[model samples]
Target: MSDYCRICLEEDALDNLLIPCNCKGTQKFTHKSCLHRWQETTLNNYLCCPERYDLEQVLTCRLCKTKYNSTSANFSWRLLYTSSPLLALARKHTCVLTFGISSFMCFSFWLFFPILFNVAIFSYVVFWKKGYRFKFIGTNEGIRLRIYKIGLKVNELKSGTILKATNMIRDGMFKNSKILIVKNKEEGAVGFIFNKFIDETENIRCGGPVNQSSVHVLHDNPDVEGCEKITDGIYIGGKLIPRPENTICAIIKGYSAWDSLQLDGEVRSGLWQIDNTECACLW
Candidate 1:
């Protein structure tokens, strides 16, 4: 009546065996490594069941189809750190290439050194940028901006009236909403907005313009329900909403702006008036 790992078929040991899922007796325990390997191999078999999928990696028991509770704990740091599929693929590729090159050319240090150096530089330029620059141009009523990379633009705002636009980039009217504006020594005048803020999880996106450069705002609300993407932008609820139109606002980047000041709480809050009846504001 000894417990054994259902995955590896090995006798249960203290460090190796884990009761990941809610199964009884023989089907209960599995080796962490074995389970992880199986999950990795069969990752393609999982489908997006909106009701059951919490946007996390889940391991289901093959025998009973019950999802394991401890799957999160078993995830490696690489898997946990990658929030999107593209990033996960990048990490996997990097790991595989590094391992393959190191194993095959362990003694050919001089030959591979230049290749490795070029790869590192290429990675830095492609994946990491020197800095983030946002340009906000003033509209008659509000400001428009975009995010730039190496002088090339990536994100642009979707066209729409003020209300139907993505709330990710808010104007002065959205005061009292959880968005903030601040000045940074390095980044200059910047705005901070949250796409999702709950408990320990906080995701910040920013948008801004220069000269008459207003800080385009990027807000994240991860808990928003029933969000659907359309050709113009995203449709959350019944509204045909456009994505944040400005480049600065459309860029899907996250940063921490804990020191930013809330518009309603700041001195500038007096300059604007919120028309609750119309759901827009005048500044």
Candidate 2:
């Protein structure tokens, strides 16, 4: 690091005259590793505060704003980041920037990839629905999992919707069950048969078979202190207390629960119909 080196301006050490950017005198000569570190820091700053910092500075001189001649420093430049750190604060965000770059590159590749030039990078599965047919691409081991994740996001069910069991669900507990969906997410789903009422009080009737011990009160009371709201005027949880007139409530014990992407399969395979209008009068 001598006075000649633009980055570490010290007359204590010695290094080669690595000029990455076109700057006069003091700003020209920077060590290869030093220039790389500088580029990394610049990119980091640009990512953290995009409005304040410029991205072009990572490959150019700040003063002259000329693109850096990184013909030599381009090789294995990221390996020298641990040597000289830019700032000690917020070092955890390094992966975020790296992931952002990787994601962008992956998205670009997937977007621009033509239907003609399809390479055999990984295994795939063909999905047929309606009239359109496209291949679902994924890796070998985790392809099924990836497919499930993608399917869940696209055709996933939402909470507060009604699921009427079709004839496909033979003579099971949910055969004629018109389940009122309590909650539906990417992970799982929980609901109960609201249409079936055994009696006024809890005798033998239940919501579902999963959680039989617990009791859930589905009511139209939103003013209850600790009740979970479902849709517009419906609320779950909390006990049945004396409330306003015309506010109907169902004392349901036990509820149905489905694991990740489990209900999606049943729904798609024609086990149930996603009816928002048929089960409206029941609640």
Candidate 3:
């Protein structure tokens, strides 16, 4: 492409005047005074103060007031269970009946007792309290899970954390360019998703649900100026939604590419309470 004067829109390449104001001049140049007026109104207005938009807010759960830290990428709460020995015996009986019926159906078609026993076992187990309540928190770094089981030696355990949200996005990496943003497309809300854990020099990989199409982007790429209130999930989409403080981020770390953007019926119904506290995204 031939060099042209940006300011005058001229096609001159020699004796051109170039200034920091991004004004392009040619041999047949426009008056310098004209350039001054253009610079004051057009370019300067768009310039922003660095400090004005650099900081972001931290995130927390609205329910328990639990602030998810950057180190803890995701958080969840599960149901707890209590002891009931009477229920256990009933569950045991049901299992016996189920197996007995299967055996009889194969070898002793003539014996109906086994089938009856199996049916009884099925009912008790289905209605019994053998299942425990559980809460699960998954993050890029690890998982925090609790099982409420009566008489159990331990109530909680750290199952594991995700090394990366997706194979492409690794831990501790961020992408400032070419990020994928998802939103309602109709509502105009927007969220950001970039390749994390990028080598920067060699490879550009993003941390997310591996597949791009499954992720939802938020609308309105608003500056993460402060800790904003936790509204609907639409306000925050794709990967972990970082709080305004920059200390905590909301993430669904272990979900697969197919499951990344899906909101379960329960979550959509607003059945779950959000635990709000202060936290950030940690590697």
Candidate 4:
């Protein structure tokens, strides 16, 4: 009236039945209730880790894969820091065009063609800057910008800005290269040219145009150290020249940003451990 269970490594009552599941490279056996609990625990534990590979592995720690509830935690303030400026502006502009346009249009309906020229000129000047917005955003699904004039819908403005050609040059081969606004142009700006070369050799480009010469801004900042300025207007964490056009005030390494986001989620939910194996605590 007894059977052997692989989990407990002991004999149990005859009513117990051992079943094998398709878990690869691992084995376990348990009572009916225990088996179900084991499966749930195994599956939930596997789902908790962040997908980004940049995080270093941690030992002797466990992450619980629980649904993060932003509302329940009173963490609404987190939105202010994470939401991009371009996204906020897009929302504001759409509201103004929808409610504000009705008044402007009805008042002008009778004035008709006489004021049409002036109105057209005014509308063009006001909305022309929107085109620059569509460049960077380029078809993002999470948000959409509505374009309108005189209560008539026009087009959709997309997100993102194009990295323009600059005098900056990167040493070694370039892959996934980007322009980053590491600092303020007035206070100073910083741009980084990440080199994904096999040797992992990163070339630093830091400088800003002062008078006729491009000065190395990172060198002057005193915050960044041990980074060599390869050329003028080249330094680690220097101000971006011309600034991020439109609403893009800055760009960091996209991967790094996503990592920060994951950490933010964990912190908001109170799931982050000071020594969580998966979290490097870069935040």
Candidate 5:
């Protein structure tokens, strides 16, 4: 197939032609010299009356509407000569090249602010001779450390210890529960909701969801044989061989249990409050 130059419109000298843009068919071929001269003319027109033409039109093709390839077509200085004038034009109209003043200011600020920040940081260290001390917060995790220090920690949980649910457990079944620790150890822990009474049984309490089907008992009477004391006034897993004269007892269906370390995690996460030291009432 014979190639024709879009610029010179000649059939001969096809070997000197280069395809530079997305233009197809006959318009695809362009001579290196011819293309450079055409770009120079378009750039001159922009320089003469920039309002009459856009710089993009100088660097791009009108037909294909694509930016002209700037790579050296043939190892000639023609590309260098063509770009020198364009760079001069860019310098002459520096404000216009940036699209306006506000845009230029924004670009400048973002480009230099990070550098200025690093310089200021280094200056502070050099002036004070503190070397490098990067302390975002203290070792105890700042706010959390302050908060948990005022309460009983998860590691402090033990048998008969009382834990009240915080407002953070708003959507769960354990919300607003005052739990009395029944069995607590490394194996796991079991507690019952002391404040939630069951509707089905007159005095039986609803423990919680973890071991929902299991039943346990808590009582204040040591007279009941086989009763094991849990805390100051609490007992578990005993029989009423001889009921005491004054006994406070509850049969709880279901119990709340945690796997090893699970209860500790919950307590630390602010789900339960141990800081409350008021002589609290228990169901």
Candidate 6:
């Protein structure tokens, strides 16, 4: 018997035939797109169950009730595809309104300029929050596995593994570099490098290696001059920067190599919440 998609009753094509759940024989195969459509339709009204309402609800096979493996990347891609255009439209409207009102109030420029600026900044924050935000998991050793979303905890990189480092440069060359060196007795050393000056109110552009794990070093921050590891945390220059009790640092994980420069490729990685800071690993 030939395999076919159980959902659409179509012949299984290599590209579309995906075994999302652990069902057998005729019930085994379904188109990825079809599965997503079915999930959205079925789960749209059911958000009461906390366990089934998250991303797992999206990836779980409704028929077999099993989760899909290796679907995080694709799930996230689909999510961006489905949600980004709406966000872009909202952002456009916000920009037009802010600029239009500001222009109309040119007579009272001094009085309204700051207010308009604040409003514009607030709009950007809304855009960032609703669109997508990156997550970072930091450990005593270094940073680990930058994922695209919050659900895939199994694929995160383990601690003590060294990420490849490249593109070394002086911090003075870059105006907004926040650099910190991390060292652990067991994990050796790794540097947490931020290439751009983080503007809290605006969307942040994170620059670094593509796909490959690498840390860029900046030698300019007065707090990062000494580059020493204190007892429990890192020393920025001479000041001891202690680790927070239950804080998980959020990071901007860039797009996939294939999807770079496209809205479809941009996604955030890391846990949305942190309960145990001692573990340091978000997963």
Q: What is the TM-score of each candidate against the true structure?
A: 0.23, 0.44, 0.20, 0.17, 0.43, 0.24
Candidates 4 and 5 compared: the better one by TM-score is 5
To one decimal, what is the Cα RMSD in angstroms of model 4 from the true structure? Answer: 27.2
Which wins on lDDT, candidate 5 or candidate 6?
5
Tally clashing residue pairs in candidate 4: 21
Q: Please provide, for model 6 over 62-94, each residue's C-alpha lDDT reduced to its tens digit, 9 standing for 90 to 100.
A: 567776666622566356446756755765699
Off by over 4 Å in 6: 13-16, 46-55, 71-73, 77-283
Best by lDDT: 5
Q: RMSD of candidate 3 to the true fold?
A: 37.4
Q: Could you tell which candidate, 3 or 6, scores higher by TM-score?
A: 6
**Which stretches in model 2 have alpha-carbon errors above 4 Å?**
1-156, 200-205, 243-245
Compared with the true structure, what per-residue lDDT tens digits does model 1 show for residues 31-126?
777777776655533343324432244445656766666442345533542545764466569978788889778768777888999998887676
Clashing pairs in 5: none
lDDT scores in order = 0.42, 0.67, 0.33, 0.33, 0.72, 0.44
What order do you get sorting by lDDT, best first? 5, 2, 6, 1, 3, 4
lDDT of 2: 0.67
Sort the predicted structures by TM-score, highest score first.
Answer: 2, 5, 6, 1, 3, 4
What is the C-alpha lDDT profile of model 3 across 1-283, one tens digit per residue?
3455445666644444332221223322332333444433332333343233211111222223443233322121111012234434655698887888898787765577778899988865654455433457565557877443222221111111111122232333231312223321221222233334334453233435434334332222234443233232223333335433443232322122212212121123332122222112221
lDDT digits (tens) for residues 1-283 of candidate 5:
5678899898756577788888998798988778878877876888788778765666678999986775623323335446766766877898786778778789999999999999998886674453222223233334322111122236668887789999988977788888887777777788888788886456778898755678887778776788888877778877664656688767888888765655776787788877435215654
Off by over 4 Å in 4: 1-116, 125-176, 185-212, 217-283
Candidate 2 lDDT over residue span 1-283, tens digit each: 4556677774434446666756777676767767778878887887689679754556657778776664735543333333224432235578877898899999887887754345422223333232122334443344433223222332537778888999988897898888888887866788888766667464335688765778777778787767888877778776456655776777787788766665777787688788878655555
Q: Which of the predicted structures, 2 or 6, would earn the higher TM-score when compared with the native?
A: 2
**Clashes found in each candidate (C-alpha, N, C closer than 3 A):** 19, 1, 59, 21, 0, 4
- Candidate 3 lDDT trough over 10 residues, lowest sum: 73-82
